[model samples]
Target: MSSVRRLRPVWADATPDPAGRPVQLSLDELGTPLAEVTFVVVDLETTGGTPAECAITEIGAVKVRGGEVLGEFQTLVDPGGPVPAFIQVLTGITTTMLIGAPPIEEVLPSFLEFSRGTVLVAHNAPFDVGFLKAAAARTGHAWPGNKVVDTVRLARRVVTRDEAPNHKLSTLANLFHATVTPNHRALSDARATVDVLHALLSRLAPLGITHLEDLATATDPVPEDVRRKRTLADGLPDGPGVYLFRGPGDEVLYVGTSTTSLRQRVRSYFTSAEKRGRMIEMVRVAQRVDPIPCATPLEARVRELRLIAAHSPRYNRRSRFPERMPWVRLTSEPYPRLSVVREVKAGDGATYIGPFSSAATAQLAVEALHETFPIRQCTRKLPLVAAPGASACVLVEMGKCGAPCTGHQGPGAYAEVVDRVRHAMVADAAPVVEAHADRIAWLVAQERFEEAATVRDRLGGFLRGASRAQRFAPLATCAELVAARRSDDGGWELVLVRFGRLAGTARVDRRTDPRPAIATLQSTGEQVEPGVAPATAAHPEETDLILAWLGKPGVRLVAVDVPWACPVRSAEGLGDPATAVAALVRPRLAPDDGAPVVRLPGAGTERELDIAEARPVTLELDDARVIPFSIRPPRTA
Candidate 1:
C-alpha cells in the first residue's frame, strides 16, 4: 500500500535541528521512572516492503514526554525512481507531485535530530526502524543505538485479541480512540501509534510496571493472579539473599536465591513474561515474600539448599529429595561388602562414602571398590565355622574370590584385605593401584591385551571414585572449619562449617571490624560431631554443597579446628581417569607368530590373534562351574 497524493512544496534549504541529545538513561537504569522518559513515535512511507529494495518516500515523527507532545517532524523525500501506478493509487503520492521533493540525504539527518534522546516507538517497529537504520548507514551517518518499543507487542499484552480483532495500526487506533486516524499517511500513522503507546502505558500502570524494562518485557503471557500479586515484591530487600514465597497459610510456595536484589528477581514473576504455569500458580497463592539477607551469593546459595531441604517446598524440585540421595557404605560384618544405601545409620560401624546424586553413581563407586579389592560380594552373614560339604560358588572356582565363606581363606587374611579397602576409601590407594598395575602386566604377558585394558579402566574408575571419597573424608571428619571469600561489595563473606555441614554464614560490612561478626557466627553456629552418620548429622546435603563451593575459584580456607589433609599417596595423584583409561584401551597390533593358541571353526590355525581380536570362550569345568575367557594368541618376542 502506498500514498500518491503528497504534493507539498519543497523547502529551499535543509535546516537540520541541533544534533539530537544522547539518551540520558544508562542500560542499568531500566527501573527509571516511565513518566520522565522521552518517547519518539516514528512512521515511514516507503516505496517498497523491504529496506534493501525500498526507499523512504516520507518520514514523520512525534516526540512526547509525560503524555504531552513536545515536537513534530514531517518531510517528503525524492525516491530517485518512478513511483509505481499501484502504489500511487494506494497512497495518493503521485510521481508528478514529488518532482522536486528533497532526497533522503537531507530528510534523514533532520529526522535523526528530532528523534535524539528518546526511546523510539512505532506500530510493528522493525519495519520503520530498519528503513531508518539503512538510510543512516547509506548516508554515512552513525545509527544511534536508540532503545525501541513496538506498539504492536505492547498492544498484545494490554489489549487482548478479544478486545481488538487484530493488532493492525488502524484497528488499535480505532479501539483506543486515537487522536489522528491512520489513513496510510506517515504523519497520521505516527500520531495514531503515539496514542496507542499511551493507552498501553495506562494498562501497564495497574500491573505495577512503572519502569522502562518492565514495559519492554511486558508481552510475556502472565496470569491475572500473578499480575495482581506483584505488590508482594514491592518492599523486598534489594540485596543478595534467599527469598521465600509463602501462601496465606504460611506454607512455602517457592524458595530461591539471587546474587542481585531479591526484590528485582521476585518482581520479575509478576510480569506477563513469566511463562511457567507452576510459577504463575504459586504466585497466585503467594501472599508474602520472606527475604533472608545473605552477606554473599555463596551464603545465599547454601541457605537456599537448606531451606529447600527442610521445607520440601512444592515448587523446589532440586535438593528436596536429600533422603533419596544414595550413599556407598561398607557393610558392618566379619566379611564387609560395598553396598548402596539411602540412609547412613549411626553405630553401624559401616564407612559411608557419599550422598551421591543418583544410585547409579553410587553403584559405580561400589563396583570400582569391588574391582580394586577382594572385598566380599555376598550378602549372607558368615559363621566362624564353614558348613560341611557345601559347594563353592563360581567366583571361588574362578579364583575371583578367596571363598572366605567356605574357609578357603582365613578370617585373619580376609581382614587384612578389608583393612586395605578401608585405607583406599579415606587415605592411601597405593595398594589398589599397585595391584591393578600388576594385574594389567600379567594380562599383557599372557597375550590378553583386551583384558589388560579392561583391568586398567576398572582401576581408573576405582581410583577416581576413591579420589572423590578422599576429598570429602577430611571435611566429614573435621570438627569445624571456617572459609571466606571476597563479596561483590568488597566485604568478607564467612561461613562456619562443622562436620562438613554449613553451621552458619555471615557477611561482614566493609566498614565494620569482621572479628566481632566472626565471633558471633562461631558462637551461634550448630555444633556437629565429627564422623557422625548422615541420619544423625546436622545437614547431610551440606557436605556435598561445601565441597562444590570449595571447588570454585577465589574461595580461601580461613581456618580449621581439625587436621585437614589427604594422604600423600592418595588416588587424586592419578591423572584424568578418562584420559588414562582411553590410552590403555586403544587398539594396537601385536607381532604374529604362527601357532594354534585357541581353536575356532571356519578360522585357520595359522591366523595369529591378538587378545583384542579374540572371540569369547566359555569353559565348563568338571565341578559344573562356568568360566568366561577371551581366547588369546601365544606371546612372541
Candidate 2:
C-alpha cells in the first residue's frame, strides 16, 4: 500500500547506474541496420540525484515498428520510502495515490513482458536506459539484447546547434514545435520526448537518421552512469513457463510465457513500455517479479492455465477451466428419470435437464415442454414422488395433462409423450411455436371457438414459458438482472436479482476461485473489473431486499439498475423507497393515476405491513388513498 515511489527499489538494487543522466546517439552508431527494426522508446521518472541514492517513480515506454507507434506502457512504483517532497509536487503523485500501487518486485514481470524483442529508444537514451539497466541488474536480469536509439544525439547531428543553450527535452520540444504537456511526470514527459524525436527524425532523415544502422553510432553526449551499466543481460536461460511479478498486496503484476531467455525477455519493459493493452496494464501494476521456469512451451501453456485459474489474477483474459454440464431432476416415479437440460448441459451428458440457475427458469422450461406435448406432470412417473400411486397432482386437474396416471394412458404411450415434450423444450422454439400458431389459426377459421381458445391459451403459454425459461440457461455468468416499477412520484422502484446463481444452478459456468468479488464493485476506473464485491451485509442491499420480500432467509447478491437521473442511487434508494413511495402510493384522484398498479401481492396481519407494503394507506395530504399492494410466493417456491 505504499505510494508509487515507495514501490521502487534502491537504485543499486534494480539498476546499475546510481545516476540517471542523459545520453545521446547519432547516425554513425547505426552503421547499416535495416529501415525497420522493432523499436521501443523508454523513459523513467525517478527520485533525483543518483540511481544508487534515489529510486524509480515511474516507467513509461512507447513501441514503434517501421516508424509507426504501436502502443504505450507505464507504471508507478513505490521507492521504498517517502518520496522526496519536490518529487511529489512535480509529478502530481502523492502518498495517497500510491496506497494501492505495488512494489518493485511485483512490477518486474509486467515490465519484462513489455520489453520483449525491440530496439530500445529514448530521447536522451543513456540517462533513461542506464537506470533501467541498473534496476535489471538488481533483479538479476540481463541487459536487453536490443540496441539503443538516442534522439538527443540525433538532434544534435541534424540541427547544427550553435544557438542552443541546452540539450534538454524542453529545448528539443520547442525546437520541433511539438506540444509538451508535463515535464516531470514520466508518461507525459516520455510522450513529449517521442514527439521531439519524431520531429528530429523528419529533419534528419536526409542526414543518415533514415536508416536504423546509420543512427546507432551517432553520439552527442554520454553520461558516465549509463556507460557503466551498459553490459547486456547475461546468464539468461531460455525456458517455457509462467512467470509472476509480485508487488504490494501480493499483487500479480504480470503473467507470461517464454521459449527462452527469461531474464532477457522480462528486462525489456525497462527498455520498452509500449506493446499491447495487456502488456501495458501489466506494467502499470507490476512491482517485484519472478518466473516459474518451464521445460517446454507446452508445459508452459498448461501451467499458465493452472496458475491463472488458481490465482484469478487481474490481468488474465481467458478462464482456466472448461465449462460444466447442467441437468434437471424430476421427482415423479417412472423410475425417476434425469433430463439433460440442453442449455444448461448442452452435450455434456448431464443426466438431468434442469440444474437451472433458478427455480423460476426451471419451471418455465418445464411448462413450455408440457404445453407443446401431452406430458403428464404426475408424481407417479417421477423419482421424487413419495409413491407410485400418488394422486394425479395439480397439473392434471388443471387439464394441462391427458390424465395418464390412471388407466387413461399406458407407460409406453406416456413415455413417448414425455420424449416429445423433451424434444420441443430442447430444440429451437421457432418451428414448434410456428406449428402451434398454425393450428390455432385453423381452429379459429373453422369457428371452433372453444378449441381455438384452448390452442390460443397453449400458444400464449408456450411463448411466455419459453421466454421465461431461457432467462436462466446460458445465462450471463457475472451479471445480475434489474426490474423497475414506476412510482407515482415520477420515480421508479428497483428490484435486483442474482443471475450468476442461475448459471451455476445449471452448472454451465463455475469459478475456480470462490472468493466473492471486491474490486469491481468499487472500481472508479473506465471499465468495471470482474468478480463480485466481497460478501458484506452492507453490500448487495437490493438483493437482500428482494429476498426479504420473498420471506427467504439468506444473504442476497445484489445488482442495481437506475435511471440516468439517479445514476448512483440503488433501487429503492437502498430501502428508502417507502418514503418516496408515500408520494405515489397515496389514494389518488388524478385520472391518469387509475392506470393498473400491479403491486407485489402479499398477505399477513395488518401490523406486519411496512410503509412500502401497506395497502390502502392514506397520504396525509388531500386524504389520498394508496392502491392496495400484494405479494405472492412463486408457485414453485
Per residue, candidate 1 scores C-alpha lDDT tens digits across 404-424 of 888888888888878878888
Could you give candidate 2's per-residue lDDT for residues 423-529 as a string of tens digits? 44443344345444344333433435466445434444344333323322322233443333332334332333343221111001132221222222223212222
Top TM-score prediction, candidate number: 1
Q: Model 2, 163: alpha-carbon shift in Å?
A: 5.4
RMSD (CA, Å), candidate 2 to true, equals 24.5
**TM-score to true structure, per model:** 0.70, 0.30
Model 2 worst lDDT run, 10 consecutive residues? 500-509
Alpha-carbon deviation at 125 in model 1, angstroms = 1.6
Candidate topping lDDT = 1
What's the C-alpha lDDT at position 569 in model 1?
70
